[model samples]
Target chain A: MVALEFWFEFASTYSYPAAARIQAMADQAGLTVVWQPFLLGPIFQRQGWHDSPFNLYPVQGRYMWRDLERICAALNIPLRRPSVFPRNSVLAARVACAFAAEPWLPDFVRQVFHANFAEDLDITKPDIIQTCLERSGISGHRIIERALAPDNKDALRLQVERAVALGIFGAPSFLAADELFWGNDRLEQAIAWCKVPSLVGIA
Target chain B: MVALEFWFEFASTYSYPAAARIQAMADQAGLTVVWQPFLLGPIFQRQGWHDSPFNLYPVQGRYMWRDLERICAALNIPLRRPSVFPRNSVLAARVACAFAAEPWLPDFVRQVFHANFAEDLDITKPDIIQTCLERSGISGHRIIERALAPDNKDALRLQVERAVALGIFGAPSFLAADELFWGNDRLEQAIAWCKVPSLVGIA
Candidate 1:
């Protein structure tokens, strides 16, 4: 089975819906899904945006919240507007990065997303990260300690650089053999590209 | 049965595919489609973008082109990269705005999109606009004169303000009542919103 890279930012609303279903889709398509968590903060800073684009552009922001609600409804996923928009996702990203190879990594990723989007928890807090890690079957503060290790932090930084190199400008981007597809809507297309790449002329 | 307002910009690459398909979708659903031509230039300018966001962000721009190619290929639509990133669309927009109520408006719209995206013709050229209009069965330069009238130009300006008031920040946006759905991907959701507004909990 060909591998499909799922690039997501924990703070991104669309990535929530994406995370909820990508595993099933990958399993069905006989493809391996590699979940890569990255920070949108660095990328946005490069674009001169100090905040989420939703906050930077209020009209789009309002539309996004509404759009997200509708999408979550359609997908049968529970969602709530967190009091804090784009809660600090560094710790969440670091956890995912540190445990990228663990079989339970996707489970942890979803819990982090749920904590931020559904439970409205601050993902930056160590307790929240620990809870998510524990829910995925990992216990104690050691996991969080490993997640905060300098090497793991550096790995995530390099991953964001790799994402930029691959021309990713948005969250929930999918990469099927170097070809990038942006947005939650493109998940199907990316999967298709991985399953039947020749049809898209993707060599 | 209901009205779907399709907001488009001739210079927007994504709008090309959108213009090609929206009419057919509207027809099949027994809906009225109101074709709206607005300048993204003015809107983007307000956002401090002097050029197409695609031009300002080349990484995204590259992904967009490849994605567009795949989309066009999927739909069996022909496309060529225009020499100009975003040709001055005012003339084409004025023509669309001038003939908004015409039954052939959608036809003219598709032709203009095909001219720019498929034929790689400069849509801002009078000859090109005239050609598109003529192909849609309206002959002669008289229509062009009417399209260039002062009131018609003002009407187009008013229409753009209406679009902004409606919270449209990009092209290929659909408005089902007060609900704004952005992008070609959202077309189906917008239609569903119009058809079954109840399921979405949209009032």
Candidate 2:
């Protein structure tokens, strides 16, 4: 079976919606999904952006908020803008790197996205990250401390670099073999592509 | 029956997809779709943008092309990037505006969008626009001449201004009563919203 890779950033609001639903949708479509957590900050920095492109474009930002509201409402998901415009997702990405191979990685990633967008929490702060981990019955302190280890940090950076090399510049990017599908809106097409027989050999 | 307003720009790629399927989809959902053609160039100029936001952002532009490819493929539609983007859709918009009350306005708009994107035609040029119109069995020369009339130009400008007033900053915006859904992806939600009794009052 061809497994699709989903690259997401915890701080991305649209990624939140996609991460919350992709697993079930993929399962229904008879596809395997591999969740990959990466930091968009480094990628954006390389592009000479200090902030999200949406934030840089006021018109886009406004339209994005409204567009998200309607999309969330339709999906029956609760979403609120984060208090911090762009939360420090470094810690979250680090933890994600450590948990990347774990069975709970998808759940953990979903919680982080939900906390950052729906609960409007500052995901960058250790306290909030710990709280989220604890609520999920995981050792927040131990996992977080391990995530800060040199090897783990290196792993996270490598993931970001890999994304850049793969021509990825945005979050919630899906990879079906060699084809990269960027943005949450393309999630459906990404899943459908995985179902095609032609994609099996490519992966 | 509540009427859902579909505000589309001729140069919009995704609008082509939505415009092609929206009427049938709305019919299945038991809602009415009103096609409103407007020029995004005027709106962008008013907002101080010299080009489409996708073109201004390189990463976005690259992703848009890939995303459009995936989307069009999924929908079994052929799409090719136009050579001259941000095509002076002024003439097309004028023709669309003049035919706003026509029963075939939706199909006409879809053909124009397909011509611009799928056929890779310079929709801004009168000859190309005329060819598309002629193929659609409409009087290309007559429509083009009438569309450029003083009154039609003023109407198109007013339509653009109205879009801004309605808080729309993008193409393929859908309005179901007072609620607005932006982007071609939101067409389903827009149709669903039109079915709600409470929203019907706003219409």
Screening candidate 2 with a backbone cut-off below 3 angstroms (N, C-alpha, C), the clashing residue pairs are none
What would the per-residue lDDT of candidate 1 be over residues B1-203, giving only the tens digit for each residue?
Answer: 69998999999999998998888888898888888899899999998889998999888888889888988988779999998988999999999998888988889999999999999998988999999999999983988899899999999999989989999999889998778899988998888788877445532
Chain B TM-score of every predicted model: 0.96, 0.93
Candidate 2 docking DockQ: 0.25
* DockQ, cand. 1: 0.48
Q: Model 2 off-target regions past 4 Å?
A: A197-203, B45-48, B197-203
Cα lDDT tens digits for candidate 2, A74-160: 677788888787788999989988988787778788788888888898888899889878776787888998999999988988998
> How does each model score on lDDT?
0.90, 0.81
Docking class of 1: acceptable
